[model samples]
Target chain A: MVAQSTGADAKNPIQVIERMMKLLDVLSYYHDPVSLKQLALETGLHPSTAHRILAAMGATGFVERGEPGSYQLGIRLLELGNLVKSRINIRDSALPLMQRLHQEIGESVNLGVRQGDEIVYVERTSSGRSSVRVVHLVGARAPLHVTAVGKLFLLEDGLPALREYAKRTGLPGLTPNSLTSLPALSRELDKVRRHGVAFDNEEIEQGLRCIAAPIRDDSGDLVAGLSVSAPAERHSANWAPLVKQTADDISAAIGYVKPDQPAARR
Target chain B: MVAQSTGADAKNPIQVIERMMKLLDVLSYYHDPVSLKQLALETGLHPSTAHRILAAMGATGFVERGEPGSYQLGIRLLELGNLVKSRINIRDSALPLMQRLHQEIGESVNLGVRQGDEIVYVERTSSGRSSVRVVHLVGARAPLHVTAVGKLFLLEDGLPALREYAKRTGLPGLTPNSLTSLPALSRELDKVRRHGVAFDNEEIEQGLRCIAAPIRDDSGDLVAGLSVSAPAERHSANWAPLVKQTADDISAAIGYVKPDQPAARR
Candidate 1:
């Protein structure tokens, strides 16, 4: 399908679908109701051709008439979009990239999300070295404060939320090194917020450490976290930038747009 | 445009758009790769015509050629769907239903969503009566445990989350009847979870009480809450069902489907 862009934009395209799509493109570009003349001008379609196509699309609720000779994108697009959003599996988009990252770092690359106060691991790719533990736990849940990815969520929730989380969970300790007090956790969260990455230093278990970065949605909401986990002897803070980069790669794979960057459009 | 549906299916449709959409519908309907014969049969188009159109659409990434003659829906729909999802405003769909609910209940109907620890009012329609105290707070943020709509979000977050919320906010008191402890909030949330509705009995402000129901999106995720706020003296528990119904109506407007019900399609 990708090879026919030239044909699609030629005077004739898909017999009629491309013309209809061109009209839709115009409708999507304009936030306000667009006049027939304006739409035809934008798409290089004859007014009669554009009108006929718009009327045909309007029948299917793909385009909506606003006032006389004017139209807007229709509600049907929203319905289809909602269906697509529901169907999109983040794990599907992240899997190949997770495999790539696992190969790059030679460690377990994992993806996890919050379920209540626990971060549930949804996907993982291992180093195959098998020296470090923690494998085959696809549906495992861990406390939010004890894992590197969990801390990204805590930072996302902000300081007051961290204080509340500590107060409520009593900052239960999984290890002696786990920061179980409000101040300590708050300080850790500060670094996570500053660096846009987090770490679990023998926190969840002995001799295991991890570094994680947040994965966001197109809405800029934190949807998941990507982490590189390894044995304490093998891990380093130097992996921070690479972990963050892979997380960003997964974020882009799953349609997240950084606020500083302009969103790409079709 | 709708009246032309009959013509669309008779033999030819829109010069080619409908037939292409028919192919798309079949592709979308099938979860796996569809053979050329199957699509041609499904859409009543000749194999050559189907192949030609599929080739054209394949060039545009709207359809992907799979093994040999097999085809599947492509990634372009996801990109377009994401665009549509971002552009959709809940306020646009909710306002009309909120107005209808306001007209029925003679009270202020409001829409809200959680923003961190606060429930921000996004859209609303007030009864013609002048008894309500809160209005015109489109971007205002209030503590999640205080507003009627806020309770729905708390309920959505579940009990342990509710416990954390109580511990975090200390169930801050804004009025004499405001819930100020975990036990009271737990009991309140139970009723909300059971009845699928929540209330604010002069909790945010004296003399202003509210009844609320959760509004979910396509994935059954509670995206917002719909509420009717009125003077405490005039409020009634009997309004719960109507409020819930209106919330469901708005949920449907924004493409939320009930888990037990089959989704409607084009």
Candidate 2:
């Protein structure tokens, strides 16, 4: 019966669903409630189309209407997000190691995974003293070009995919140090590939700096990024090796044997 | 236009919305991917109806189809959940205090908030020892009758509301210590209300114990619960006062003044 209905009205239903997905993606970018006009503009949907989709979503508690035309991501999302986060085993496995790194370095340590064109923080340990706030809250997302962990993921994409990503996000700059040109970003990524480490020197935020290294799974696939973040004044060249070592330790714990190491006979 | 459309098809649309909400709620309960048959049976929807709704949701990235008919909560929910979690000020304010308490007591500390009929763990600090493998992961949910923090919320509900909750959840028991009868739950809550603390002596899981106290906002509304959890052998009667004090300290940090304290001179 459903297949028959889809055969008759496939075009309209799919279009509506695509528009709704775009509207939801736009809402996810915000940390506060967003107006319908703003959501429409961001999603490139007409106000009426966005409104219709949002009304249906609101009815299901997927979106909450605030004040009048404003909307926010609902509590149901939080409940679901927690469920997703809990199911990801790497987070539980990596947290104690991340905590030890934070304790030793007295800097924020973060665990992030590549999600589409961005990096989503799955876990983090906060640096207690920095008055300059780093907004890498757990579950926070940042574009690949603007963060240390993101840079490592971008480096894995090679130049062709990197150019496509640069085109998609418009190489948006958050600070003067942000790499906005293709040549600059490519050069930075080259350094990252060679050194197995990435750095954000006041790139995302003016006073914040971060150092990141790759975490691999049993298959030796780059599964996550581990980073230590600190204020620019406190940031040191010394932390890079330590960050890379901790990332390697986590990678080994997860069953990745280093490529250069001799395999032991069973 | 939407209002006019709703006027024309009010009943069906609202029913669809209710069914979709029920499907999502059911999916939230299992950390692993669930099958279409299981979801249909659980939600009391026809398999075809469930499939059609899930396909639309999958198009929106609200659900992910895996291994044919199996479905899992999507990453979009995690993205949205993070946004909601970041907006709540209490989680940020409570973390440092919770850290301090964990450091002092060497027990697992959890931060949870009441969401409908269950408690959702928003944040937690894990104990370094005890291989008991507590399943209370972040974003994990437990019924209100089974946890110490949950009992605090039930205590706030008063006797009439408590009776309603007991009926709704059937006073389900996880262990022999669990309150499976309304009379027993009411008696436990009476002690909680009087003493300003709640205890779960292996009610949720055998060989585990928890002590919890309420956290309030400036307006004196109980907003969250802070608790310490440990194994039965390691659990101490002496920790109750300390847990209550730590909870009070967190509450104070979030602007809750004790009722007994005189108002500060402006």
Best candidate, lDDT = 2
Candidate 2 residue spans exceeding 4 A from truth: A1-16, A41-49, A91-213, A216-266, B1-17, B91-213, B216-266
Reference-based TM-score, model 2 = 0.38
lDDT at B68, model 2: 96
lDDT, residue B33, model 2: 90
What tens-digit string does per-residue lDDT give for candidate 2 at A1-266? Answer: 12222123333344555555666666766666899999888766778867877887786556888679999776556556656655656886688889888878887899999999889999998657556556689999888899999999898888899989988989999999999999999999989988889999889998999999999864468999999888888889798888999999887655455655412111
Candidate 1 residues lying further than 4 Å off, grouped into runs, are A1-26, A41-49, A126-136, A172-177, A217-220, A236-242, A252-266, B1-13, B31-37, B51-266
Model 2: native contacts recovered, as a fraction: 0.47
* Model 1: per-residue Cα lDDT at residue A71: 90
DockQ per model, Cα: 0.21, 0.17
